[model samples]
Target: MQFELQKALPVLERTPQVVESLLYGLPDEWIHNNEGGDTWTPFEIVAHLIHGEKTDWIPRAQVILGEGNKEFVPFDMKGHIKEGKGKTLSQLLDEFKILRKENLAQLQALGPTEEMLDLTGIHPSLGTVTLRHLLASWVVHDLTHIHQLSRVMAKQYSEAVGPWKQFMGVLGGKR
Candidate 1:
């Protein structure tokens, strides 16, 4: 378990970078793809991530830091995506970037203590998870959507006819 946690930290550290890479150079139209009427575009995903960071993640982190037994609620990603419907891709990405940086700062400030690893709140889906698990999941969530955004970008590029399309194929890997 210790070895696994150590390995996961580097992935957590890469969340911001993953987000930047995932949303970089996305087209404006692609940001508002209400095509299927049931899917989130790249812009919506960024906004949802920002909302998660601000509402779900930070409060839980504070609770884990010995503040109180505050109940951590799950974020409403669908609602956030809807609320951010008209925002530009750049605007959403910038907000997500700022929120992610703040999360990283808070995580960095934790002392190396077992108390830091305590499981405080029970996630409705994930059940009881430690601070360490929550921290790790934060990055995993970022990475998961990073891949999703890249796929959206790739599909958009594939529909285009240019050298940029060829470049997109190489850039958008599932890794």
Candidate 2:
């Protein structure tokens, strides 16, 4: 589907709630174990989302809006490891909710126009991008992590499911 800012806000707004539903207060099995080495657990993904909320989406939009730097600084993909240290899953969830809420409010307050949506910013690596793309990505990025949370959790049951594994596509092959 074509990206529409109006079409996207609902997903963006609900992402925190959705993520919180999945991870808040879950057991270590669901919150800590990942699909494998270096893959983020559900808990870390919350921190990653919090990191993106602070550094990625709205910051990049503001840059394109001519409010700040013309180019986005490279994001630290693993920044969540340190950022999440000493924080509980519940705290990360709460932080994500607040950060996302404030960022959305700021985006609306920026009052983007049709022309503004087409205005561009330089990504540190991907090069030129539009406000529209950034907004759409923000939506999909939320969905991606939600999917990751489900997939990682499902995989926790991969061995136990046995013959039923074929019915569970989220538990994709190869562990």
Candidate 3:
């Protein structure tokens, strides 16, 4: 698929609202509940999303646009726990909305061209990647987390869902 910034902007811009719509005002127990094992709670997911907004997408884009082949700083996948310490879900949501808006504006300001999209950078683990790959990943990352949040919330009713569990793929299906 082509990398059209105009097309990507709306989805990127709407992610925070989509998360809020899915999660806001839900009971604390429900929002904080995890499916056990290594699963994340909805609260932790939001925190991680916020950390990505602050540290990942736009910063990597800047490196691709400016530094050419410079290797990216490896992202801290587990850093959100410290970053989100002492904050409530509502606070994290509000902060994410603000940060996402600012990042989207910065992306627009960069005005990436086709050549810019083709420019490459070195990822610590993924080897060479392009701006096009980064931008597309940003959009997909939002969607993946949205689906994760939905699945986590759905698991809250795993047992309560009764025989309908067979039809409700989210409850029993592998992620």
Return the top candidate by lDDT. 3
Residue 18 Cα positional deviation in candidate 3, in Å, after optimal superposition? 0.7
When sorted by lDDT, best at the front, the candidate numbers are 3, 2, 1
Q: What residue runs in model 3 are displaced by over 4 Å at the alpha carbon?
A: 173-175
Residue pairs in candidate 2 whose N, alpha carbon or C atoms collide under 3 angstroms:
none
Cα displacement (angstroms), candidate 3, residue 168, comes to: 0.5
**What is the clash count of model 1?**
0
Q: lDDT tens digits, residues 1-175, model 1?
A: 4524457667766766677675567567766563355866777777777778778766787766665565567666576756476776677767776777777677667643566666566776777778777766776787787777766665655646465554554344332
TM-score: model 3 vs. ground truth:
0.95
Q: For candidate 3, which ten residues in a row score worst on lDDT?
A: 166-175
Model 2: residues with Cα > 4 Å off, grouped in runs: 67-69, 173-175
Query: Lowest lDDT 10-mer window, candidate 2?
Result: 166-175
The better candidate by lDDT, 2 or 3, is: 3
| Candidate RMSDs in order | 4.7, 2.0, 1.8
lDDT of 2 by residue, 16-111 (tens): 998887777788879989999879888889899999998999888888987656899899999898879998998898889999999999998998
